[model samples]
Target: MNNALEPSAVALGTAGWGGGWGVEPLDDGAWAEAERVASDALAAALEAGITTVDTADIYAHGRSEQTLGRLLAADSGLRERIRLQTKCGIMIGGSPLYGVDSAAAVESTRYHGGADHVRRAVTDSLERLHTDHVDTLIIHRPDPLTRPEETVEAYLELASAGSVGSLGLSNMGVAWVRRFDDALRAATGGEEGIACLQIELGLHHRGLVESAVLVNHPDSADRAVVGEAGGLAELCAERGIALQAWGSLGQGRYTRGTEQAADQDREAAAVVAEIAGRLEVSGEAVVLAWLLKLPWRIQPVVGTVNPDRLRAAAQAPVAADRMDSLDWYRLWTAARGAPLP
Candidate 1:
């Protein structure tokens, strides 16, 4: 968190910007091309008013951070203008993984966030990112092997040394966040805590919002948010932890007009499309605005290289200006495929 302000609304995602990610992964040649495209996209994104870029060490097996490093190295001035946030903890093998379904295997990376591993991870990330300090350093996943107290001690050490600023989490549960935060506060004596919660949340995945909307229904068969109390969302709201959403535009499922999630997306995208048409904005903007209307302000992590798309995404808050409260629920229900009980 290099003393930079938090990304106000939306952040550009560099997951696909690196090389190997998304529906179809790339090869060596394709990866080179991807780096070129991403560098160009990053320039366009900064010019388009996006100040935050989210990436991870495992992304493209570190090519993501390396590519970003190259860009930053070339333009020393760009370093100050933008905030760099990268994650680690998950490691990737040499194999080039492709497609969305197969991409899940990458998560199986052994989660190791002990003092030694966090120290090594941060050092390696800084080396790859080619920066002295990152605006925010995130733990990609919880390490079952290490206790929260032990992990936060190393994190606090980094923060004190200015090697890292704000701490973060990804794909983590509520209990874990609480444990980590408790440990962090104990270590710092209430001086610092998690800066944000990055999770898979959007029109395509409403687990965070669904828990609140579902109330005490306790029905997991119909919705993914029903199982637990979804204390994370509540905690984030109460604690003022900004909720940053990944895959906010359905990850091309909605905007591409592709039949990625045909049955489910058909109805959801229809409502979003109708709204976008009425508002005269891109479909991506509409979906994003819907997420923004949640109780907490959601910072969207969008992966788009096209300059036009980046600017269109920046218009999310404005596109939402035309939406009424009723229309907001309409979009939610459409995505849920069922009216509120």
Candidate 2:
């Protein structure tokens, strides 16, 4: 916590608070429960010095935004202490059977990558979040058909107009990130650059490392990769960029009660559990501590509506360096069920 990197800025992901994305929907009673859970989680997060949150408009069909809005409205002081980051571009439609709408489905049928649409979506998100300006605004994903310059220009315009404090991009390849970074720099008269790049990085998903090699593209020196982001630790050392790690717990596959917990998962969990017991902590604390041990600045975006779990996660990094290299690799190999070459 006292490192040069401000781990306290670790963000809380609100995707689960809205209860979407293959997760159970929150009924009226569940919504009330979520409010209490979120409130308690937020209280604990604030107390633990975690003051940033990452939410998305499409999460739970805007339910996440609404819930966050309500929470911030209830406590104005909390609003000031925290920095809100939300995404746009992904569209979702209302539904009855699926609880809320599906953003991916909506975009597939009626996708428009225009500035007007971007403005309208951000405005709606701001309304739901009950805030005038978002600390960070990211495009959930780039439209394959849209021009990079056009999208970057739109984001630059928003920043210039003071609608968004900073602009970021998500789910983009290394080429796209560099292209947008250059385009935005030119469009903004070199006044601003990308604040961050959000991507999925964890023990199981090391694709970012392979992708970084492709982004470097020795064959295309003219198109060098810009805006460095990779494995949480590597990226931190290379570019001084913050790593916002999503799915830090492998989407709950590592948990004890989940059906996705296979033998490999159980074995990995056992290793985590043993380490936790030795450290006098929870399994989640051990997983997070491992993440914190990496050289980079990682802010795991954990998505749980449970306050107790949130508190435990906040304390996970307390003994980051206690685990030896062999133990770390043992857990890593068990999690992968394979040895490194």
User: Candidate 1, 20: how far from true, in Å?
Assistant: 1.5
Relative to the unseen true structure, what is the C-alpha lDDT of residue 224 in candidate 2, on a scale of 0 to 100?
A: 30
TM-score of each: 0.89, 0.80
Error of 2 at 45 (Å): 2.0
**What TM-score, to 2 decimals, does candidate 2 have?**
0.80
Per-residue lDDT of model 1, residues 41-76, tens digit only = 887787778888898877776678878887888787
Check candidate 2 and list the clashing pairs. 91-103, 92-103, 233-296
Over 1-341, each residue of candidate 2 has an lDDT whose tens digit, in order, gives 11122335357888877555533456798778767777888888878767778888778767788888888788766667787788877654443212334444553333335676677777888888887777888877877777767777776677777667777777766566666667777887977667676777665554543334545555224323233343333533454446677887666666554245776688777777777778777666677666677666667778766676777777766747577777677777777665543
C-alpha lDDT of all candidate models, in order: 0.78, 0.67
For model 2, the superposed segments whose C-alpha errors exceed 4 Å read 1-9, 19-31, 93-113, 209-240, 257-260
Candidate 2: minimum summed lDDT over ten consecutive residues — where?
Answer: 1-10
